[model samples]
Target: MFRHAFRRFPLRVFGLVALAFVMANILGGLIGTALAATIGLAVFLPLFLFKILMVLMFFRFLMSFVGGYGPRRPCSRGRIKDRLQEPPAEPTKEETEWREHVRLARKELDELFPDAEQFIE
Candidate 1:
């Protein structure tokens, strides 16, 4: 098991290196080659990504306060009331099973108390 994990470790490392290189190239392309070279790709890449995330989150927070009803809550768009008014075409299998279970429970309770009227009183 240890050997298997070790074997795949190099492949995972290689993938990470490739990803870093790609991100560095993207950073270099967007923000100029000189800046990328000065800051160094390894250190700057994660910081730059974190800054972007923070800026986006800050803007989202600001918008929530600025707006009227920040975002619309999801609601039932269909005629749910009408659907409820209309009876189900047929009792579902689960519903049938539930009814059967309830019946059995009631029967067991009746057996426990032979006189139902005395228990109610």
Candidate 2:
């Protein structure tokens, strides 16, 4: 449903809000790289990634309380489904049977009372 609306956050739509966990943590790498260059701690790659990870952890923890409003509201799923995918136009089994029965009964009545139409004048 929400697959196309938010293509970037597709995984998050399926109720698994923790998929791209490292997304917010990538900053740790940036911090580590900055520190390495400034202080000659030059271990940029590994340590920077780790710093980004810790930052991600902290941010994720904070964001856990903040589930933003998605493209579709929770209450709107049922209503949208109901409106979009309606039943086919063909008659129901019971309705078809009832209509057939009425046709037959009218035919019988016409045959039994053919003269009834003439007396109407």
Candidate 3:
């Protein structure tokens, strides 16, 4: 019965069915490739970002040490420490105010808990 019905259809129907199958296969393959690419990006993108960030951090570390502000090593004779330890700079107004605040806070704490000192240290 199906062959009889199929015979009633023109040969164009067979060609159309074949073309539809080919189009569907092509579409499926394209979708599969897109999904695979999406998955690859999802897996590798963060690793790539982390690699870039690590490179940036390494450069920052190198740059930080490039200036004279980085940590210094002692000289063979150990006089580097002595030479580097110059007289302290004069305190600014903010420093003086901070010191006064700390002194008052300490005095108040001492008055509040004279016996607390025994527990300290």
Per lDDT, the best of the predicted structures is: 3
Residue pairs that clash (backbone atoms under 3 angstroms), model 1: none
Q: What stretches of model 1 exceed 4 Å from their correct place?
A: 1-78, 115-121
- Model 2 TM-score, 2 decimals: 0.26
Model 2 vs truth, CA RMSD: 30.1
Counting clashing residue pairs in each candidate, in order, gives: 0, 6, 0
Candidate 3's residue-wise lDDT over 12-116, tens digit each? 787899999999999999999999999999999999999999998887667565543224533323555666787878999999999999999999999999899
Write down the worst ten-residue block by lDDT for model 1.
68-77
TM-score to native of every candidate shown: 0.32, 0.26, 0.50
lDDT of each: 0.80, 0.72, 0.83
Write the residue-wise lDDT of candidate 1 on 1-121 in tens digits. 9999999999999999999999998987978877767779778889999999999888776666643323541223334556778877898899999999999999998898878858685
The alpha-carbon lDDT assigned to residue 18 of candidate 1 equals 99
Worst 10 residues of 3 by lDDT: 68-77
Clashing pairs in 3: none
